[model samples]
Target: VRTVVDLGGVTFMDSSGLGAIIATYRSAQDSNGWIRIAAPTEPVLRVMQIIGLDTIIDCYPSSEQALNAAEQ
Candidate 1:
């Protein structure tokens, strides 16, 4: 199983979003699933990078890429 998160058009994110993503990732890992983020805006990407999520989550240049990666 796989989950793709879309961050496009998201100009800002708070701890809630971060926590949600973290929880989702953990859940996926527990279930032997993969998770990815797609097309995050610059600001969102920066936040993810700063929080070390960029290294943890599979990030793609576009949603299609993410979806394809997940499918694979």
Candidate 2:
């Protein structure tokens, strides 16, 4: 299974959001699934980078691309 999280509408994200994403990633891994972020706003992307999440999670330019990658 795969999950695509859309962050285009998000204006900002704090530690809580990062934590939630990490938890989801862990859960997906445990379930033999994958999780990716799609079109995150600049602010959110910056936060992810600061926390080193960008290197771990698959970040796509768009949700469609993420979904397609998950299928493969």
Candidate 3:
């Protein structure tokens, strides 16, 4: 269940959204899978960085990079 979440169009994100991603991450982990975030808007990326979510999940500058990494 490798996942690449494309956030290019997402301009905003709050705790709830973050929580959902966390939950999904946990679920993926439980299944020996992984999740990655890609192309998050600056503000959203800042929020993630402030919360240290960037350390928990890999982030990429583009969805193609994320998906490509998943393949590897």
Q: Judged by TM-score, which candidate is best?
A: 3
Quick one: how many clashes does candidate 2 have?
A: 0
- Taken over the whole model, the C-alpha lDDT of each candidate is 0.90, 0.91, 0.94
> Worst lDDT window (10 residues) for model 1?
1-10
lDDT of 2 by residue, 1-72 (tens): 468999989989988988889999999999999899999999899989988899999899899999998888
Which residue pairs come into collision in candidate 3? Answer: none
Candidate 2 has an lDDT of 0.91
For candidate 3, write residues 1-72 as lDDT tens digits: 678889999999989999999999999999999999999999999999999999999999999999899889
What TM-score does structure 2 among the candidates reach?
A: 0.94
Question: If candidate 3 were superposed on the true structure by all CA atoms, what would the RMSD be?
Answer: 0.7
Off by over 4 Å in 3: none
Select the stronger candidate by lDDT from 2 and 3: 3
Candidate 2 — which residues are off by over 4 angstroms? none
Question: Would you estimate the TM-scores of all the predictions?
Answer: 0.93, 0.94, 0.95
10 residues in a row with least lDDT, candidate 2? 1-10
The numbered model that scores best in lDDT is 3
Cα error of candidate 3 at position 31, Å? 0.3
